[model samples]
Target: MKTRAVRMYGEMDLRLEEFELPEIKDDEILVKVISDSICMSTYKLAKQGKKHKRAPQDIDVNPIITGHECSGVIVQVGEKWKDKYKVGDKWALQPALNYQGKLDSPGYSYRFCGGDATYCIMPHEVMELDALLPYDGEAFYQASLGEPMSCVIGGYHANYHTNKQNYNHAMGTKKDGNILIMGGCGPMGLGAVSYGIRFENKPKRIVVTDVDDAKLERAASVISPEFAASKGVELIYFNSSKENAEEELLALTDGHGYDDVFVYVPFKPVAEMGDRLLAFDGCMNFFAGPTDNQFKSEINLYNAHYTSTHILGTTGGNNDDLLEALQLAAKGEINPSVMVTHVGGLDAVADTTCNLPGIPGGKKLCYTQFDMPLTAIDDFEELGKKDELFAKLDESCKAHNGLWNPEAEKILFAHFNVEI
Candidate 1:
């Protein structure tokens, strides 16, 4: 079949072109893409190119696609996968395809596969590992959001603290303890906040801190302090740009310290601040992936040793995490839709990804079949004055108080002449 995709040749080099996909082998499955959400990691990979660990090393001869967060429908099934996945079934892909420790992933490793493309082929490894998941949700974007949500869940699972009694250790977040999320206004941080507040282990309280009050306000509105309070979970948003922000947070915890801290940004000053604020037996998760190969920051190793405060970092989620994210979304425990802030089409992915860092918002969702440019929900009202399509989209989103929902997605796809 003739397919079109955005391929990455090198850093600052991405091209959207048409190519023919070879017939799939018996172990492969052909999928038609639905929705793809642009992740900040894709921006880092696009800029870093060959320097990225998960990205393929070869360039001029063998370029790869450039999107990991995506959703699709099974259009053709191989003989081997026929019983497991049939045509017309919705599916999601977990990008962390650790094939014998080889640094190969769908978007970064395969030329005929990527979330930003019109179509993608699920190769043998993806099927065998059960990474190509069957999705039962009505909203296709939920599948795309699954990958990132899984990363958040994995961070919480990977966190651990030493047991003072046995001098052994305990993994996962402190059960029924206080939790702090640094820079929690961002998309990923917001997911952590939502997941943390309703974690099965049940935290006693959660405080999300950020530098900008406006972002915090928006975060509060999205997550809703009132909702958290109604659920009997204390969710507080604090502006930490002030000089006394640390003191205020310490005071909130009665000067003891937070039980768990999830740091979303890797800035040296902020990272060091996160380090110093760790309590005895506290687990600090440096969740953000660093671009610099030699990234360094000061850590109080003396306190780390004496207080048993340990620091850990994670790159991405495994298959189990991805499944958990989907399961949670299915059960109404977590809403992946809370992360989306902007919607666009395939053509806008290149620009949207290149300017992702400068752009401030949550997840940017792209519909592969549409021809629209990148449009933020905040700008939908303004754009409605010119484009009637956006006018309807503006009203649809406004009906839900400016949030992405299944109805809005249906309106967009129908207006764009794509089957929902």
Candidate 2:
């Protein structure tokens, strides 16, 4: 079989080409990709290309497809995996290959096994780790959102609540305590907010901070303070660029510092601001990763010793977190759709991924089976009149308040002329 894939040939080079895939080995599984969500990390790797730590060593010999957050249906399962999986099974990917701590993963370094394609091969490491997981959900975003949602949960799990007095006090976010989400207007931030309010051990107050008021407003409409209040959680949106940003945040926390601060942007000043937002024994999660190796930020060590404030950072997520994300989503406890503001198809992903940083949305969901360009539902009203295909999508999303659901996905996929 031949798969059409967008491959990274070198720095600033990505090509969509058709290639004959090798026969599936006895231990391999072949699957057709469905929905995928573009991540900022993919943009980071795209710009850095061969220079990226997890990127292929030599693009000439090892060009790979990009993107890790995805879900798909198993079209053919290898004989070895047949007992555990079937041809019609659905799955999500953990996407982290901690193989002896080597930098190898599907989207970043595996050419034929990545998610940004019509189809792919599952490598030995993926099978060994059981990352291709069986799932039960209606929206493909459940599978696509699993990796990122796991990351949000993993960040919480990775934190440490300090009991030791002198050298260090605590780690992780305080359970049922005040929390701050820095740059919380983006896709990942929305997930963090959803998880924060809906978590069993919910916080007293969850503060979401951003520089853009419009984004803050839009976010408010999605995960409204009214909605959060129903769950006995206070959700507030603050524009950090304002003069009273810190004071306002502290005020929401009842004059005490935030017990947990999650920094969603990688800029030094934001990190610096996040450091200041930490309270005594507060744990800071630097969620957004910077590309530069020499990037440095000013941290308050005196406060670290005096107030026991410390910080922790992590990449991707582990397997268990994926399952937890799926379970929570299945129960309707958390809405992953809030993170997605745009939806398109495989043809749009290449361009959308390249210009992700500039694209103004939370998550850009892509359906691989269709041939549509990157299009945002917000613009549907303007474009719908010009095109009937978009007219249907706009109508569907309007009913859900600009959110994409299984129905919207089905409507959009049905517009495709050919069967996939």
Q: Please write out the lDDT profile of model 2 over residues 150-191, one tens digit for every residue.
A: 999888777766766465634446777988899998989999
lDDT digits (tens) for residues 176-281 of candidate 1: 7778899888889989987887777667788998888888988888889888887678889999899898898888888878889898987887788888888888
The top-ranked prediction according to TM-score is 1
RMSD of each: 1.3, 1.9
Clashes of 1: 0
Q: Which stretches of candidate 1 lie above 4 Å from their native place?
A: none
lDDT of 2: 0.84
Which numbered prediction scores highest in lDDT against the true structure? 1
Task: Report the lDDT of model 1 for residue 21.
Answer: 88
Q: Please, what is the TM-score per model?
A: 0.97, 0.96
Q: What is the C-alpha lDDT of each candidate?
A: 0.86, 0.84
